[model samples]
Target: MSSIDIQHPHTLAPAKARKAVEEVAKKLAERFDVEYGWVGDTLNFSRSGVDGKIALQPNQLHVSAQLGFLLGALKGPIESEIRRVLEERFK
Candidate 1:
């Protein structure tokens, strides 16, 4: 298995950040077949070949995902896309 972990800084208020993440989650669901929901300030998400959590903090967003064998092969691109989206959203 491979791992995709990313931490990003943000400037939005908690509520705005939550909204931004939820929107990103929806987009991810469409592309990656992921399911996600909030548990306190964290968003937990998963699919058949992937599981992850997005931890929303006072000044940062921490994302961690574990990919099963098949999906693991695409880790590089996946991580890149994640970083791209995060950069776009947090800007």
Candidate 2:
């Protein structure tokens, strides 16, 4: 499997962060056929062909995603799309 991880600081409160995470997860789940959930303050997601986790800290958010496909198959585009969604929703 290939993995993509990203972490960055944010200024939002935990509640807002959690809400944003849920919103993003829902969108991803619907559009990408992924399953997502919340574990404590973290968001966990997995799909038939992918597995991943997204966590939110007081000042930062971390994302770790793995794709079961070949590295050249879906890695770059998937990661780019996820990053774009995150950037749009979190900012």
Candidate 3:
């Protein structure tokens, strides 16, 4: 398995940050078939070959994921896309 762990800082308030996360999650659901829900301030998600969580804080978002064997090989692009999305949404 391959793992991705990113800590992204943001200036948004908690409520706004949560809303941004929800928007990201909705796009992920539609584009990647990911299923997710929030538990406290953390948003947990999973799909066929991936499992992850995005933990929201007042000024930061911690994204962590574990990729299965096949997808692990494509980790670079996947991580890049995630970073792109986070950058676009949070900045």
**Which candidate gets the maximum lDDT versus the true structure?**
3
Residues 6-70 of candidate 1: C-alpha lDDT, one tens digit per residue:
98999999999999999999988998788999999999999999999999999899999999999
Candidate 2 accuracy as lDDT? 0.81
Give lDDT tens digits, candidate 2, residues 1-91: 7888988677888899888888888887788787887788888998777778889987888999777766438788877887787777776
Judged by lDDT against the true structure, how good is candidate 1?
0.93
lDDT by residue for model 3 over 1-85, one digit each (tens)?
9999999999988999999999999999999899999999999999999999999976889999999999999999999999998
Worst 10 residues of 3 by lDDT: 82-91
List where candidate 1 sits over 4 angstroms from the true fold.
none
RMSD to the hidden true structure, all candidates: 0.9, 1.6, 0.7
The residue ranges of model 3 lying beyond 4 angstroms of the native Cα positions read none
- Location of the lowest summed lDDT over 10 successive residues in candidate 2: 65-74
RMSD of 3: 0.7
Rank candidates, TM-score, best first: 3, 1, 2
Judging by TM-score against the true structure, name the best candidate.
3
Clashes of 2: 0
**Off by more than 4 A, model 2:** 70-72
Query: Against the correct fold, how does model 1 do in TM-score?
Result: 0.95
